[model samples]
Target chain A: EAGVAQSPRYKIIEKRQSVAFWCNPISGHATLYWYQQILGQGPKLLIQFQNNGVVDDSQLPKDRFSAERLKGVDSTLKIQPAKLEDSAVYLCASSSIKDSYGYTFGSGTRLTVV
Target chain B: SQQGEEDPQALSIQEGENATMNCSYKTSINNLQWYRQNSGRGLVHLILIRSNEREKHSGRLRVTLDTSKKSSSLLITASRAADTASYFCATAALSEKLVFGKGTKLTVNP
Candidate 1:
């Protein structure tokens, strides 16, 4: 099966700039997740979508980070006025079931905020 | 927030040796999963052990879950250099939220 797909494998932006990352989940997946991973740290959940509706976004920094899964297929994560601390790998994952099956992840977008 | 905590932040072993990583978490969980992430790559699911199941095996990977102790262990037998990567343990709670821990960096020297 095809794996989750992400674009712009790498991105570099100046602090206070805006950047967006796109992700296409695996076919037939109903749940999509966005995670942020800092250097030498574990991936932290940024947001979660069950189909097109959000199921969780408690960890997302709404002031800067926003995510949307439109049409319940693809998702976009955007960071406005990016901060230096926001430089990290943004990962996307999808699962056939919510919290039941294993997730299939995309290679991720390595965002560098200068 | 992170739920699981992996021990021995790093491990270095020679090929053909065995490497074991342990994870401990608080609160009750519905299941626990193991994932591998190669440098510059996304995480790949390695295995999953439910709260009811004590253990599970996939290929050369063995995972043991002890709910009573709130801990789990991942043993990689006959490790190969190709197996070098970061291993993470994630817990799925009743709320249906999956949380990951600080991963263990494993290096298998050939």
Candidate 2:
């Protein structure tokens, strides 16, 4: 089985710039998620998508961070006017429909804001 | 927001020894899962124990869950140098979101 796929394993940008990360989830999976993991901390859920609709995104910084999973297969997370504190790894994960277990994660995109 | 707290934020052990990490959560959970991350990269699922399960074992990893106490423990037996990584416990309720702990940094010296 193919694993979740993320693009641009690493990226560096100056503060206040905009950056986008892409994620391709496993085929047939209905649930997709984006998480932010800072150094020495656990991964925090930023948003979740069930199919083409969003299920949860309360933690997302709506002022700067935005995510969308269109067509219910691939997803993208964007950070505009990035801050120094936004430097962290963004992880993408997927799971089958109605499955609470067996979450497959991508390698993640490491963002460094200078 | 985090639902679980991992004990011994850091741990160091020699190869052939055993390593144990504990986690305590604040709310009711439908299941608990453990994951290992290497070099702050992607995570790999280790094991999942449902609320009804008391213990589960896979390869060298063992996980025990206590719903009454909202706590869980992960034990790595006969540890090897390759076991070095950060281990995290995540708890999930009826929702799809799984609340994760801060994680435990484990170093198994050869």
Candidate 2, residues B1-110: lDDT per residue as tens digits?
Answer: 99889998999999999999999999988889999999957999888899999999999999999999889999999999999999999998877688889999999999
Candidate 2, residue A86: lDDT: 99
Q: Chain B alone, model 2: TM-score?
A: 0.98
User: Scored by CA lDDT, what does every candidate get?
Assistant: 0.93, 0.93
* Per-residue alpha-carbon lDDT of candidate 1 for residues B1-110, written as tens digits (9 for 90 to 100): 79999998999999999999999999899989999999999999999899999989999999999999999999999999999999999998765567999999999998
What interface RMSD do all candidates show, one decimal each?
0.9, 0.8
Deviating ranges (above 4 Å) for candidate 2: A97-100
lDDT of 2 at B4: 89
Q: Chain A TM-scores, all candidates?
A: 0.96, 0.96
Worst-scoring 10-residue span by lDDT in model 2 chain B: B91-100
| CA error at residue B40 for candidate 1, angstroms | 0.9
Using all chains and alpha carbons, the TM-scores for the candidates as numbered come to 0.98, 0.98
lDDT of 2 by residue, A10-40 (tens): 9999999999999999999999999999999
